[model samples]
Target chain A: MRVRKLIYLLWATAVFLAACGGSGKMEVTNAWGRTSPAAAANGAFYMTITNNTGQDDKLLSASAAACATVELHEMYMRENDVMGMRQVPDGYIPLPKGQTVELKVGGLHVMCINKQQEFMIGDTIPLTLQFEKAGTMEVTAEIRDSAEMPANMPGMQHGGG
Target chain B: MKQLLPLFAFLLLLLAACQSEPKYYGTLWPNPQEVADFTLTGTAGPVSLSDYAGKVVLLYFGYTFCPDVCPGTLADLGYVVRELGRDADKVQVLMITVDPERDTPEQLAEYMSHFHPSFVGLSGTEAEIAAIAAEYGVFYQRHEGTAATGYLVDHTARVFVIDQQGKYWLSFPFGMMREQMKADLQNVLRRG
Candidate 1:
C-alpha cells in the first residue's frame, strides 16, 4: 500500500511539472529546423504547440538568437501553381483549449530572417515563442543529421490550391 | 435487348483499353511544343539545354534565399531521383534563379549539391532570365518583405519536364508526391 501510494505521488508530480509552463498552461514539442546553407539569408523552423490553459490562447510572436529576427509566417497558394508567403496579419496563432496546433512547412512556420549563424545539419537553434497567457517559452529547434532527417515533405494548403 | 447491351458494353471496354493514351501525373500541355535552345551559366560556364540531349530534364524557377516552398519542392524532386536507383542519371533537375542578383553561380552550385549531386543550378543576367521565363510560362516579380527578410520574390513554382526531343511535356505543380513523380518519370523514360 505504501509503495503504490509513492508511485502515484511521483506520477502526479511529473504531470504537475509538465503542465507548469508560463501560467501553467502549454506544452511545446517536435521543434525542428531545416538545414541552412552557408550563404542563406533566412532559415525556417516548424513545431507543435499544445494549449493546456483550459481557455483559448494566442501565440503573439517569436524570436531566436540564431537569426537577427523572426516572424510568425504562413504560406498560401496565390494561384494554380504560385505560392506566396507573408506574416500572419492577425498577428497571432490561435491555440484553443485542449488542442495542438502544428506549424509546418509550406504552411505555418517561424521564418528566421537575416541569419546570424548557419543552421548546419545536426545543430540546435534556440527559439523563444511568446504566448499571450503562457508568457515566453524557449524551444530548441534541432537540424537533424543528414542520414536521419524527417521526411517532412508535405502538401501546401489554404486560399485554394 | 439486355443480352445485346452486355455485348455492346464489352466491346466498348475492349476498345477503350486498346486506345488508352499515356498518362502523366502533372497537367500536360494541350499542344506540346519544342522549347527554343537557351543558354544559362552553370558552375561550368555557359551551359545550354542541348548539353543533356538524350536525358530527361526537370526545370525549376526559384531563389536560394527562399526558405520554405522552394527547398521543399527540391527535396521532393531529390526523393524521386534517389528512389530511381541506378537509373537516376538519366534524369536531371535544374533550378534557374528567380533572384539572379542574390543567387550567384557558386552559391547555386553549393545549394544544388545539398539536394542531390546531379541537381544543377543556373544563373544568368536579369534580361536573359526574364526572356526564358516568359517563354516557359514561369512568372516572377520582386517585392518588399518584412523587416526580418529584406525582400522576397513571388514566382510560379511548377517543375516543367522536358523530354529528350526538347519538347515541353507535362508540368508538375508544387506538392506533387514523389511516388507519382517517379511513376510519371518512369513512364516518360519508357515511352521515349
Candidate 2:
C-alpha cells in the first residue's frame, strides 16, 4: 500500500511538472482501447497527448497489427439532435507547442478498423503513431471496458470536440 | 415583475431538486406524442414496445458494430442503471439496431451483455426499422466507407424516452452525463 501511494505521489509530481515545466519532450499517456464484442467490426482508442516539444507537431496517422486500417476520427453534432462521425478532414491532429490534447470517449479518437479479432479486457493493442516532427511513437494501449474518466488533474479535461 | 416572481420560484425549486413536478434535463416535447407500438426480434423472440408498459423506456438507435458513440452511450446508461440499484427494474433500455443486416438478434444480445444484462437489443427488417425510425423522427442512411467496415450508417444519436403511458416524453442528447440521466429517470419515476 505504501509503495502504491509512493508511486502515485511520484506520478502526481511528474504530471505536475509536465504541466508547469514546459519540458522539450513529446509524451503520450493514458492510452487505452475499448473492448470489442464478437460482432464488432472495429475498435477505438483514447489517450492524452502532452506535447512540450517547444515546436508544433502533428499526429499524421496510426497503425497497428490488431487492425488492418486505422483512421483519426471525430464525432460531432451533425444536425438537429443527431451525432455524426467522420474521419478528420485534415487527416491529422495538431499539437501546438506546450499544449495538451485529450482524445476522449464520444470525441476525438483513433479508429481501428477491420478488427483481426475481438479485443477482450486486458489485451493490449500495440500502436505506431506517425508524427510530423516527433517521428514515430510506439504506444501500447490496453483494452478496457471503458475509457478512464478525466481525473481532476490539471489540463486533463476538455469538451471532447 | 410579477412574471419574474414565478421564474424565481421555478429556479429555486430546480435548485432544491424538489419532487413536485421536477423538470428533467432531457429535451421535453412541447406536445408529447404517443409512440407507435412496434415489434422487433429480441433475444426472446418478437418483443413489442407495449410489452414493457408501465416502465420508462429509452429507445436508442444504434448497432453493435459501432465502436465509439454507441458504446459510450451504453456504458453511460449501464452506469446510470447500476447506480439506481434495484430501482433500475422500472427502467428499460432498448437499442434498436440501425444496421439490421449486421446486428442479428443473437449478436445484439451478446453485445448488450457486455454492458448490462437488463438492457435489450432489438433488430428487424430494413423496412420495419425504417418505418419505426421515421415515426420517432430518426433519420439514417448508409454511406460507403473502407472495405474493412463494409459500410457505415449515419443515424440520429439521440435517445428517446417513452413514458409509462407510452407517450414521447423527453429526449436525451448524445454525451449526456450519467448523473443527469439518473436524475431525469428518478424524476420520471417519482412523478409517475
Residue-level lDDT of model 1, residues A3-73, one tens digit each, is 99999999988888667642456889988887766667777888988888777899999998888788888
| Model 2 Cα lDDT, one tens digit per residue, A1-161 | 99999999999998887667555678999899887776677789999998888788999999999888999987766566465677777889999988999898867899988788888889988999999998999999998876654332222212211
TM-score of chain A of each: 0.74, 0.77
Candidate 2 residues lying further than 4 Å off, grouped into runs, are A1-23, A117-124, A147-161, B1-20
Q: Look at candidate 2 and give me any clashing residue pairs.
A: none
C-alpha RMSD of candidate 2: 9.2
Model 2, B1-192: lDDT tens per residue?
A: 997999999899887775345657777776888888999999789999999999989899998767898887788888888888878899899999999988889889988877888889999999999999999889887777655666777888788888888888688777666777788888777767
Give one digit per residue, the lDDT tens place, for model 1 in B1-192: 987998999999999988775666676777889888899999779989888888899999999888888877787788889988887999989999999988999999988878788889999999999999999888888778876576788899889999877788688877666677788888778767
Winner by TM-score: 1
